[model samples]
Each structure stands twice: as C-alpha cells, then as structure tokens.
Target: MRNDVVRLGRLSGERSGDMMHFLSSMRADRYIAGADILVDIAHVLMLDRQKINDRATTRQLLPALLRLHDKGIPEEVFDDRFEDVHAGIESLLIESLGVEAGGRMHMGRSRNDEVVTCIRIRLREDLIAQMTALLKVREVLLTLSENHTESTMPGFTHLQHAQPTTLAHHLLAYEQAFSRDFDRLKEAYARVNQSPLGAAAFASTGYPIDREFTATLLGFDGLVTNTMDAVATRDFALETLADLTIMMANASRLCEELIFWSTSFVKFVIFDDAFCSTSSIMPQKKNPDTAEIMRAKSGSVFGAFSGALVTVKGLPMSYNRDLQELTPNIWRGMDDAGESLRLLADMLASASFDTKRMSEEAGKGFSTATELADSLVRSCGIPFRTAHNIVGRAVQKGDLSLATLEKAAGEVGGGISLAGKGLTQKDIDRMLEVRYSLELRKAPGGPAPEAVIAALGERRKQHHHDAELTRKKQAKLAKAKEHLIAEARRLVA
Candidate 1:
C-alpha cells in the first residue's frame, strides 16, 4: 500500500497491488518472523567469521539486527507491500542503514534457503512443545490407571461385552498408543532440526561460506548437505504431519470412549462441569462437548495432512511458489493436536468413574464364561472341546445355576461324567465370579490387579525417560540461543 517501500530489484516497473496480495504469504509469515531474525543474525555472524563482510559493516549491521530482535520487527512491515517476512525484514534493514551495509546481511543466502531455515527452527520448537503436551496426557493416563487397578469393567468387541477387565488395563492400552506417538514425534524432531541455511536458491553460493558454522549458531543438529534437497524438500514437514495425524487418531479413539462413557445409558464416567455444557433448548442435557470437539478435530488434522501431501505430490525438484502453502497447514495441524492433548489431560484428570456400575456390568453379558469352561477342563479332567460345549449350552439355556450346568453337561458333554471329580458347584460359582476370573489370569499384560500394577510401574519409568529427552532437546536450543545473542553483542562491542 506504501510507495516508499523498496520493490524487488529484478522488476523495474510499477507492480500491481492485487498481484502482490495474491503472491503474498504475509499472513503465515508472522509465525516465522522471530525465527527469521535469528536466521539473519546467524548468517551475518557466519559472514563476519568468513570475512565476506568487513568489520565496519559487521558492527553496523549487528547492532541494528540486535535492536530488531529486542524490540521485535516493526508492525508496519506485515502489510501486503512485501512478499513475506524475509523480504520485509531485509527491506527494514535497508531503510535504516541504506543499501551498501544493510543489504550485505543477505550475502550468501536466498529467501529460498532463509525461509526454510526459519521454518525448521520454528517447527523444532513446536515439536518440543507438542512432545511435552503428549507426556502430560500420558502421565494423566498412568495416574488414572494406578488408581483404578482394582476397578473392574466390561471390555467389548463389536460393541458387545466380550471379557471382564480392570479400568487400569483399559487405560494403559491408550497409554501404550500415546507412548508410540511420543516416539514418532521424537523421530520427526531429529529430521526437522537439520539446517538448510547455506543452500541459496537451490545451489551452493560462490561465496566462501561455512554452512556448519551457521548450523551450530542456529542449533541445527546438522546440515541438509545437498543444496537442492535443502531448499526443495519438505518431507520433514510431511513426516511431522503424518506423526500428528496418527497421534490425533489415537486421541480421537480415547475421546470416542469418553463420549460413550459419559452417556446416560452407559454412565461409566461423569465429566467435570467445566468440560460439559447444558443444551440451550433442553436444560437437562449435560453434553460432553469438549470430548466431542476433540474427536472431530482428528478429522481436521487428517485433512491438513492430506492437503500437505497433495501440495507436495507433483512438484518437481527445486523450490516452487506452491511450497509457501504448506507452512499454514503445519501450523494448523500442530495447534489443533497440541490443544487437544492438553485439554484431554485436564478432562481425564477431573473425571469421576462409576466403579460400582462398572463392576456390576462386569458381571453381566456372560463375560466370564471362558473361565467357567477352563474350570471344567482343569478340575473335571474333561477335554477342552467337551468343556466348551458344556458351557456353551449353559449360556444358551440363559441360566448359570447348578441345575442348568447339570442339564447342559447331560445334553452336550457326550456322556462325560461329572461324578467323583474334584469339580463342584462352589468351584463353578468361583469361576463365574469376576474377581476370581481376574485372579486366575495373572499372566503379564493381563487385566488382573497385580499385572496391571506391574505394567503401571514400567510405564511410569518410561514416562520419566521420555520427559528427560524432551527437556534436554529444549535445553540445547535455549543454550544455542543464548550463545547466539552473546556472540552478536560481542561483534557490536
């Protein structure tokens, strides 16, 4: 909108305002503005170290750059007058210091490399935050599991009760899924932390530049090496989106369960008032709005990932204007997933379980019939097939009493005698009791309280290990930032 601002040097004539607006990525560029500043500072420091820019030029540029960093980029530069934050920052530098000195700050880099470098920096920070949110949700799950080790419930298949399980075991299944999500994010961080700064416009610059020097200053794990790959590839973004999509899918599954559990017909869980809302038309409705939204958000994340895949699918090697479209997708996916993780943690922590109702439901639906069949095989010395037939008939007769068992045995056990064996009515009753059924299956990964407690201990240990990894990565980035600022100050002094 302002004619005073410098236009691209390659184009000499007046530019169309509508064309600039159409070409602009200014809306998404704000997210990477701070990272852009860091990239500039690191590039300038590398330039000074290589003696590409004279001492006088370095001193003049460093102080102004530091000032920009301290006070933040001028708010006016965000207009459609510029193509992106990269150009906007360079233009401001030129406006203040004139072309000769301020312009040299771009000595060995192009916006192609500069923008991607900024993206990686910003994305790595986001990945760390996402990992922290995941760990918090996992911790909540572990704590809930520990408290509910003895609380029994029906575990379902095809929406019908298939077995009796402890709440601890059920919660830990989701914990295992989220633990894998954390691992995926950690792997993606390694790829996102690589530097792409020195690959100017898809080729190495003729200038004597040390890519490694800038990489270290910017806290990149390593260089992106190939110039074309550095600028052209966004598979790192794709990988991260894939991980987020999978993570949200896991979250959505748990959210689906929470929604079902909160229903009046199920009544397995009661959400806190903070997470529920009353219907405007029906005051009696206490809807699980938060969980429902989180569940729906998984589809949004999927769409973002799908859109990113489509954007990158057919692009040829080297940079294209289409790459500009991917950044907003990354931001949208990350924000949705991060907020969902945090809110899910808070929601689960505040919820109350209907343990009595869960226990009652655990006893219905022939949930322990397998245990009864196993008891017949173990105590009566009957073959498992014969035992299964006897129990199937008992269940089919719609009663589990001693009289029903005797009739079922006569009808289906092929004349197999129940006389003089150690099996008795008391034994059959014990096998049908949910607690007794649980105790008999104390193998590792089982739903028995002892097994669930053992699993909880191991998961807690894993949580500690994962949390430490996240902290170390974050600390390394902080240390690099402090060192960068100190080095800039030293140059100015």
Candidate 2:
C-alpha cells in the first residue's frame, strides 16, 4: 500500500510538465501498455496455478502490473535507463515492486511478439473505420446513379465524341470500382484476422499458454500457426496498402473525369461551391479543388505503399528495428484513403449535372456519324466499308449541314428496298431524333430508356442487399466489442 501510494505520487508528479513528452512518444505508450498487461496477466495465471505458492511474493508481483496498469509511467521518468518500450515497462515495474516480483512475469514472452500484437490490434480497429467510410461513399454513388438513370451524356473514345450514354452508366462504373474495393478488404480480413499471441520472441512459448483462448479474447478469428511467421511477416500491412493503392488509382482516374466534366468547355456538371474552392487572384474561378486534391493526395497513398515496401525489403528477419519504421507509413496511407473517400462522397452528394447541356452536346460534333453510316448500310444496301467511307468524308466536308444532308440522302437512294419499302428524308430526320435513336437501341446492355431503367432497378436491389449485409456485419462487430469489454471487466473484478 505504501509503495502503491509512492508510485502513484511519482506518476502524478512526472505528468505536470511531461505530458507533452509522453504524448509525443505515443508509440512508447502503446508498447508499455501492451507489454505490461500481457506480463501481468501471465504472472497472475502462473501464481494461481502453483501448488506451493509464495503468498507474499504473489502479493508483491500483482502490484507491479496493477500499479502500471492503473498509473502508467510518464515519458519524462525515463532518461537513458531504458532502451525501448519493453525495457521502459520492465524498469518501471522494478521501480514499483521489488525486482523478484516484477521479474517473474518475463518468463516466456518477448517484446517482438508484444509490439507486433499491438500493431495488429491497431490495424484491425483502423480497417473497420476505413471500411465504414468507404461504404458511405459507395452509398452516395449508388444514389446518384439511380437519380440520373436516363440523363444522357456523350460517351467518348480517344477524347472524341463516340456515342451517347446515360449518366447512370458513368456513375455505376465507379460503383463497381468501389464494390471491388470492398471485396478486396474483406478478402484481406481473412489473413489479417489471425493473432500472434503465444509466439514469444519468434519462438513458441514452452509454457502451457492458451493461445487459442487469448486469440479469441483479442477478437481474432484464429492464431498464427507458425510462431516464426507470426513475428517475421508484415505481409498483412503490405496487402492492405496494395488494395488501397489499386482502389485509389481507380478513384484518381474518376476524379480526373470530374475535373474535366466540371469545366466550362464540357459543362457536364457543376460542383457545389461547398465542395469546390476559389483561386487566390482569379475572381471567376470555381476551381474543382476538392476533386483536384483528391486526385493529387491519392498519390500520397501510393507513396506510402512504396515506402513500406522499401522498409521491409531485403530484411531476412526474425525481427528487426526497420519494422518499427512501417507503423507511420501504414497509418498514413489509411488516413489518405479514409479522407479521400469522405471527400468523394460529399462531392457526389452535392454536385449537379447539367442534363440539358450534356444532352445537347451528345448529338453535336458529328456524334451521329455512326447512325448515318448505319443508315447507309440498312437503307441503301451499301457495304459497311463503303458506308463508313461516305459518312467519314461527309463529316470532314463543310457541306454536311442538316439541309445538305437531306438532299444528299435523296441522291444516295430515296426508295431503296434495303431498310424498308421506302427510305426517305423523313426517315433520316426521325433517325436524327436523339431520344428516339437512344430508345430504339433496345438491346440488353444498350443505353435505351428501358435498359437504363432495368439496370437501375437491379443496382438498387443490390445496394439494398449490400447495405443490409453491411448493417449486420457492423452489428456483429459491435457485439464482439461489447463482449470484450465485459470479459475484461470480469477479469479485473
């Protein structure tokens, strides 16, 4: 009791001006918290099992962990006496309890396993948070795609107008990308869900530790079967970054299109100013700064991915100091992914498409040249090659006005039996009706109104199903967390 009072007083005194020092050494805190708790738990379990237990010694040892757990040592308390979090924790234990009681808990564990476990827990928590944010982004995208199901926009090939497509098709392209991201993360969970418990310092503990129980206690799905692999490999972190890199690469490309679309020249859409920004000197500029920044910072996630790869490269490791360098890099990439997805969701929610402008431009710039060529084949019985050549020439020539086009149609053949009984100038006019042309393309995957509506209906059903599944998974995770808190409280009680 006297020692407990003294140690608590010492901790309180060190916390006054040293709070900055402790907060800055955040990794050290994590290590201390992790190592000390594991050691204390092991000691308690061991002492309880001994046949001729030393009551006084057990009494003394219990305080080492209890004191540290209750009142952790401030960073200022250590100068040159400790080497790392492991040493710092043990050294504090010795200072609080006598060395005999403090030293017994170090029997079958190593700081290598301790530090790795801490990172694993941190990663699991972070991944769940990131996945939730990604789900929100996907939900917003789905809503936009449904709302714009029939809104026509010019589809491009080689940056030139090729055909007409609905805005819903464009939005669903991103939904598919995000859906794949979700699957990738879920796949990664199978590997990352394993625990490193009982892998003491690159080797299995000789002590009869319940590794499975501890793993379950930590909410891990299983234990790492090979003890050496548990401490040596950081492939889980690499896999996560690889997934983030691929997903962000796709997102960056989409943001590039958004940047292009929001421009006055294309005028496909206008982003709300709340999701955009103004330049310092340019008075009339509503810069797509949010989208631009998303495109730019997306590269930072890639950079962090490369940085972690380099950190782990060429290291034949049981464990090395270089592995510690990966913590910030892993977390930095995750931060970028989380924030980028949030920004994308907000932009999607607030942006408005200029359907009239998009639809108007959808038919101009010789966009109907394909329709004209098709008419030649279907009506004049001309070979497709000859039809393509004729339309291509007509498009290049300055005499391709609507009036000129009708006159030319008569010269080609006013009443050929190819398309029907009589192909006329009126048929050409009807073919040029943008809505009619689009509606006439009633094939399964075509941009016809019926197809678009059907696709929208299917996607909405999928979204509802996916959203319900996500809700169920979230509920399961919440229940697990509640169980952990209850069990931990029981252990203390």
Candidate 3:
C-alpha cells in the first residue's frame, strides 16, 4: 500500500486523466482535511441564528476542521486539492466530516469574496512593514540632510557643473521625494484599510454577517462600498506597486550618484569597505557594487510593475486566473523594494563625503555665474539681460573668483555704479554671499537653509508619528490573529 501510494503520487503529467485517480488513491486510507477561518466564523453565526441554527452540524464539521488544522497537513495540500486556499480547506473539512455536516460550513459566502479578503488582510500587513522600512530610510536621509546642510558640493545640470549647492540641499531633495512617497502611502492606506469580507463571490452574501463588525474585527476602517468592486478590483495592488516603483526609481537615482561620487574620477563619496566589491583582475579595484546593484535592480521592479499592469489590463468586470499570477509579482516587488530601502539607508548613513574636495570642486566650472549675475542686477541697476551678458562674458574668460570678477565687472560695462538705493561695496559683498542667496528666496517652498531645516524637522516628526501609527496597526493585526487562533483552538480542543 505504501509503494502504491508513492507510485500514485509520482505519476507523470501525461497521465493527466489519472491525476484525480492519484489524489483519490492517496486519500483511500487517510481522509483529506482543511479549514476556512471565515467559514468557521460563519458556522458559529449560523448556530447562533434561529433560522440556520444547527448545533449538530456545526459540532460535527467544525471540530473536524479544527482537528485537521491541528494535525498539521501541509498548506500545499490545500492548494493541490481545491481551486484556492479557502476551497481546499473546505474540501478537507468535507472529507473529514460527513458531506451533510460539511455542506453547512459555507453558509452564505463564495470564494470570490473570501480570497479577496484573505489577500487584503495579508497585503495590509505587508504594506505596513514596507512603510516602516521606508520611514527608516527617510529618517536617515533627513538626518543626513540636516547634518550636511553646510557641506557644499557641486550641483549639476545636464551632467555638467552648474552651481555650488550644499550637500545638505541635495540630500534634502531626496528627503522631499521620500516625504511625498510617504504621503502617497498614506493615501494608499486609506483605500487598503477598507474590508471586503461580506462581498461574497461577486455579490453580497445572504448571511446576516455584520460586515462592519468583521471590518472592525480585522482592524479595517470600514467595509468596501460595492460588492463587485470589492472582489474584482486590484487597485490597491496597483497603487502600492506604483508607489514602490516611484520609490525604487528615486532610490536608483541616488544610487547612480553614489556610484559616480565613489568613482576614482569624482571621489566625492567614500563608501564603506564592507559595502564594496573588488575586481577579479585589477589589483587596485574597489568597486561600489552595492550601490551599482541597487541602481540596476530598479529595472526589475519596473518589470514587476509592468507585469502586474499587463495581467489586469483586459480582464472583464470580474475576478480571473490572471489576477492570481499578480500575487507572486506583488510579493516579489514588495520584498525587493523593502530590501533596497534598507540597504540604501545603511549605505547613506555610513558613507563619508569629502567636504574639502567638494568645496574645491564647487568653485570650478564657473558655478558662481548666477551669483555674479544677481550681483550686477542688485548693485549696478543693470537689466537682467545686460547682467546676464556681462556674467557670461566673465565666465567665458574662465575666472570664477567673485572678487577678481567684481573688479573686472567694475572696470568693464562703462564702469557701472551702485550709488542709487544707498548700495555700498559692503552691500555688494553681502549680495555675493551664498547663504544670503539661498536665504533671500525664502518663499514657502524655497531651498533656503532655514526652510530646509524647518522642513527636515517637520518631516522627522511626521516620520516618527507615521512609524508609531504603523506599530499600532501591526499590534492590532497581531491581536486579531490571536483572537482568531484562540477561537479555532477552543473549537478543536
């Protein structure tokens, strides 16, 4: 009999006709058993209700499902037996208990509703975890931005030197990106927080299941409004994947910078030796492969996003097998995104910037042209076009030193004067100050140091608040799971 069971299980795929025979043959001696948590809840409700109250049926089937659940049949058996996890559990229950008793388990719901509910529950927890990791990355960026605000580096346009900006300013740009990402997640969370439990199959169930209560029990904000939409839509998945795609893309941009800055030619950043790789042949090679890998892996995430979109693109107004394939991609993308965020935070936190080198590099390539242009406008009453022409000429001469160029500017341009508006040489000097340049444009969203600092502080605070909220949500999820597990154990025990 053992030899027969082994042979039956190993039957080739060409024996497709024999697959059912294989399954039934293995179950000849031992009955297959499974359980659906929602079904159990429904059974209890049925027993409590006067119309469907059947204690004997509940007693017979509920305990059997619970017993099988305790006996530890592999989860894969459920997948192999029925169309889905929920059905597999029910089939197992029917096999263990009599068909009549098992028939009562599915009181008022379809797998359409149950499957969506289970995925939503699972994904809610996953999204919370992803958000927590994102917050950690944001915190690191914020701290780095604040600390490096004064550390000047060459800002670029078209991959060429454009101006001198604080390393803090550049870091804060990413901080801003992450802040928006966090906001996107908050918006996504609103949609994800809704429960879809009572929308059984494609339509609402007949059971008097209090959806609001189930939603509250599941820590959801409310029940999904429309039954068909609840089961058929994967918008939550799209929103999450979109946000993650954006995040991974942004992170990849940062990685590109890291890789460039760590290169021998630039050497603006020095990554930790631990995060570096070495060339097989080159004796002196210390490659920043960690950052490079991150930069490269972003494409994989985009592919995941594309795969999901294509899967759901032409599907009709109902659930389909195509949607089933989306789960693995979603899971993979989320895992990759979370890991990328974690690695990036660690890399950014420990990496060193060559401040002196950056400052030296900052003044080159005529990066201070805008500063000179502004000086001409504010001091000499020169029109912007005139000032711009004068500054461009000075830059063409390859002299970036403001003092030398200021003298040169005075010598040229018919010896322009700042007599009006009581503008003195000292005021001219003040206008030349980079901090002044940054601070003067302190509109609500300007990159002034003060503004950047304020934004950093606020973002840091919000990050903590968000993280705490996630923790509370996770705790609620755990408590709910505990309640469900306890209830299942009680019935079985």
Candidate 1 lDDT, 1-493, residue by residue in tens? 2332446544667658998788888888998999988999999999999999998999989998899899988887787778888878877888889879988998888899999999999999999999999999999999999999999999999989988999999999999999999999999999999999899999879999999999999999999999999999999999999999999999999999999989999999999999999988997999999999999999999998999999999999999989999888999999899899999999999999999999989988999998888888888889999988988898999977777877888899877656456566887788899999998778988998999988888999999999999999999999999999999999788
TM-score of each: 0.97, 0.80, 0.82
Clashes (backbone N, CA, C under 3 Å), per candidate, total 0, 0, 3
Taking the tens digit of each residue's C-alpha lDDT, what string does model 3 give over 338-358? 788889889988999898888
Q: Could you tell me which residue pairs clash in candidate 2? A: none
Candidate 3 lDDT trough over 10 residues, lowest sum? 25-34
Predicted model with the maximum lDDT: 1
What is the lDDT for 181 in model 1?
99
> How many backbone collisions does model 1 have?
0
Candidate 2 minimal-lDDT segment of 10 residues = 1-10
Give the runs in model 2 whose Cα sits over 4 Å from its true position. 1-107, 375-383, 398-422, 441-445
Which candidate, 1 or 3, would have the higher TM-score against the true structure?
A: 1
